[model samples]
Structures are given as structure tokens and as C-alpha cells.
Target: MAPIRTFIAAPSNLGLKPPAPGVAPGVRHLPEHLQQFSFASRAGAVQTIYLEPPTYHGDIDPETRMRNADAIRGYSIVLAEQVQDTVRAGRQAIVLGGDCSILLGCMLGLRSQGNYGLFFLDGHTDYMWPEHSATGGVAGMDLALVTGNGHEKLTDIHHCRPYVPEQQVFCCGNRVPDESYVQLIRQSQINYYDLDALRRFGLPATAVQFLQLVETRGLDGFWVHLDVDVLHNDLMPCVDSPQPGGLSYAELRSVLLPLLSAPACKGIDITILDPTLDPDGRYASVFVDHLTGILQDAATAVL
Candidate 1:
């Protein structure tokens, strides 16, 4: 069995300021700019590396925001280089994200070894490219960028055309997706388990179905991207984008437990927690507890 080598790649600049007021004071000392989880307790099972994003205060012009986006992309490039080195040494990579856009670097790291499948869990379909995104947030364009459909610097990371192909990618728990993004998803042939469909078929069953698909494809392995926004905003209110009718915390645990128990799964990225919104660390504490359990279970299975 191999050790679970978890790397904490924190992309702090990509986080949106907490919508709720008066919470920023609590998180002023955290270097990553977010109060995600403390890796101190899991220190034995993981090798943590904390990578910082370029500094950017959210109050800026669109041009400045775009420049900040470029800086983030650069940070991700450096992250990719480091991750490539880690994987080359036969370790699994777990990226603790500042935002979903960090997927670009993780995918590049995995792609350097060989192509891998992706299991994207989010409240929205992040398929919008630069041309299609109305908000122009790089996080919205990340999935498209990784699959070779967005901005040049992002798509061209790690000397690869795209990190993963459309057929090999699957998105689950999307309740709200832009119409144009839906059209792109349809044309690209990416598998999607929309919120309605997931509800209709319970999460455990859906996990089984998805695992069957992976088995059928004979994929190298699949990376799991767990965006906290996939959970109901009541349970996870700290994200940049909060959507209604998302999965319950228990439902998320159900889905992840089985997936992590499987040996074929490789790597994970947990994203979208903005601690500034969590006034008393309530949301962050719940998320951290769940994640700690997931990592522990996965490590135990391997051991």
C-alpha cells in the first residue's frame, strides 16, 4: 500500500469576499486568506505543502481583476510544476483549493503522468468559457479551461492541449447552469447528473452508476473535485456562489464514502469555503470534520 501524500495548494486570491458583514476580522491572520481546515492533526498521514496566490484586494477595476486572474493562473502554473514533481515520486495528490479554478493546476499535474478522468461535484455546471461567461470570473471558466476550451494561458498549462477530454469528465449535483453552458455540455458529450436526476436516484445509487461508467471506460483513474457549494447553502454558506436545493451534508458524505473506499479513485480537491462568511467557524468546522473523516477512511482502507 502507498501513503496518502496530501499537498495543500491554497489559491487564496481567487476567493470572493464574504457577502456577510463583520466576519473578515476573524480570518485576518490566516495566510491562505481562508479558514479552510487545519491540516495539523492529519500531519502524520499527509505531506502538506502550502502555496500562496498573488495578493489581490477584491475592490478593483475589471482590468485589474483580469490582471489578478492572470496572476492566479501563474500561481497555478507553479503549483502544477510542484505537483508534477510529487506525482513523479509515486504519491497521491490532494489539493485544498482557494477556488474551483485550482483544478487547472491539479489536472495539469495528473496529466503529466497520463490522462485521467474527472468527477466534478458542484452546484452549477462550470462549463462557461471566456466568451460565454457573463460574470467573467475565472472560477466559472475553470472546467472549460481544463478541457481545452478557454483562455490560452489557462488551457495551455503544462505544455498540454487539455488536461482531460470531455468524455472522461463527469459533473454531478449541478442545480443551476447557464443556458449557454448547458448547450456546451450537451455538445461536448460530458456526463452530467443534474440535481433533479440525482434526487430522483439517490446519491448512493448514483455513485454506483458512476462507478460502473468508470469501470466500463477502463480509465486510468478519476480525480474527485468536491466543491462545498454542492451542499445546501444552509449547510455550507461560506462559498462564493451559494445555490439552493443542493445536496445535504449527509448526502455528500454518502456519495464520497463509497468513492473514497474504491481503490481506483485517485486524488481529490476540496474547494469553495470562504471563512470570512463563517462568523463563528460553524460552517468551516462542519466541512473540516467531514473532510477529516473522508481522508481518514481513505487512508485506513489503503493501509
Candidate 2:
């Protein structure tokens, strides 16, 4: 079988916590965790180039939470370079993240290539506005920043306004959106499906519908931003903010495999899994195996 290049990078440095010296609180030894699993061998994937930058910069300035986005953007540029090179080489990217905030860099890197949609699969909507983001938690306003609805620092990266446009983006599997943000969601043009809506449509139907939309819009391709918190709290409680209901591991696997296998899915970012919470490393192992399984399955199809 031909080698399936997976350009993996770690950008787990910009969350809600204060800056530390190493991996920070929520993300510690992620790349090492995956390395031990030997998942690349199991999945028939070649991690051509793994970019793991040691950073401890998730803190938002207490006095400048809302204004700190530019600072974070500067930090993101480091990882963005790795992401850009990986994609430009025509390889699929598998980003092992520190937090959902790393998403800004990944999308920015892809935007440099051409227009691509975003598949935001998370437990929370992460659609908070800047004025509402006094705490300066980039993870909370992830979707908002990408849509050019937040402060200029994050929105105008490389002058790529609205890094991922609302029209080409589809957010699914989010069960929680702060009460105040619901109205904003309703007003946006981006196609969003909450957990309830996904359940009603069913995962298979939802996957099919999403792919159709990608095709209909004629987007260059699409990138996936996966916050493992989207999994059931009982199953994946290692994330920062735990939500109650989510897709069971099996359900997410079934849904995600199809999407990843699709030709237009250029890359993916997996975030929000904290090893400190899973002292035994069981969760990280399972998560790695699950993702690798999907890639192996996709590789098998072509083989």
C-alpha cells in the first residue's frame, strides 16, 4: 500500500489558563502519548513530519482578555508555518492539539493554500462574541473568531479576513452554546447542527447532508476541528469543560470515518484531551487507536 502521509503538529499552548513553562494544565505530553501507542504502524500511516512545539502560553491577560487575541495570533504563526508546509505538500494533516484555540493557526495555514470549509465537531458551539469574551478564552470564541466576528488580531491573520467564512463552515455535534450565544447562532449563515438536531437526523444522514453541502458550495476542500469533548462525558471527561450528553465512541467513529475518507477533507485537528485527568493513559490510548483506525480504514479502501 502507498504511504498515507499524516503531518501531525502540536499547538496546545493557548487555552484559558495562565501561561506555564511546559505543556500547561490541560495538555501534557500529547505527542509522546500518541508515539507510545505505535498507532502510525497500526493505521498504515506515515507521520512524515510531526511538529511538536513545546509551549506554555494559554493564559489571557487578566486586564486584556479580549485584547489578547493578537498576542495569541503571533504565537500561532509558529505552528501555522508547519501546517502550511504540510498541506502545501499535498499530504493530510493530523494535528494533535493543546486546545481548541490551535484551530486558528490550522485554518490560517490552510487559507493560504486556497478556500476550504470547516467541519467543527465539538461538544460546545464555541461561538461567543468579543464583547462577551472579557475572559479572553480563545477556545470559547473559536467559531466566532474564524468567522471574522471577533477582535481584529485573530480575525485578520495574514489579512485572510474571516479565515473560514460562515458560508463554507458547518458546525455539528455541539450540545452546548451559552444561552446568550444562541441568538447569534440563529442569525448566522453557517450551517450548524446541535446534538439534538444531529440525533433527529441521525449520524448517517447528517454525514451525507454535510458532504452534500460541501459539494454544493464548490469549496476547495474542508478542514475538521474535533474537540474530543464532543464525546460522552462518561467516556471522554478528560477535557477542560465537560458537557453531559455527547456521541458514544462508536457513534463518533461511524460518523467521522466517512467524513475523513471523503476526498475533499484536507486535514483535521483533534483537541481538548487532558492526560492529567487520565492518569492511567487509557483515554489517550483509546482516542489514538480510534483515530488511527479511521485512517487505516480509509487507506484500506484505496489499497
lDDT of each: 0.69, 0.75
Which residue segments of model 2 deviate by more than 4 Å?
1-3, 18-23, 48-64, 67-71
Report the lDDT tens digits of candidate 1 across residue range 109-201. Answer: 778877678888988778876567555566677777788886566788656968988888878888885565578776777787888887788
TM-score of 2: 0.89
| Poorest stretch of ten by lDDT in candidate 1 | 22-31
- Candidate 2 to native Cα RMSD, angstroms: 2.9
My TM-score estimates for the predictions, one after another, are 0.85, 0.89
Tell me the TM-score of model 1: 0.85
Clashing pairs in 1: none
Q: Report the lDDT tens digits of candidate 2 across residue range 1-303.
A: 433567565745455555345445656456566667885566554664555554555545544355245556775676677778877777777777767778888888888888888888999888886567655678778888888886677878878887888988778888765666566776898888888888888886777777888888787788888998999998888878787879988888777877787877777888878777887888878888788887777655541
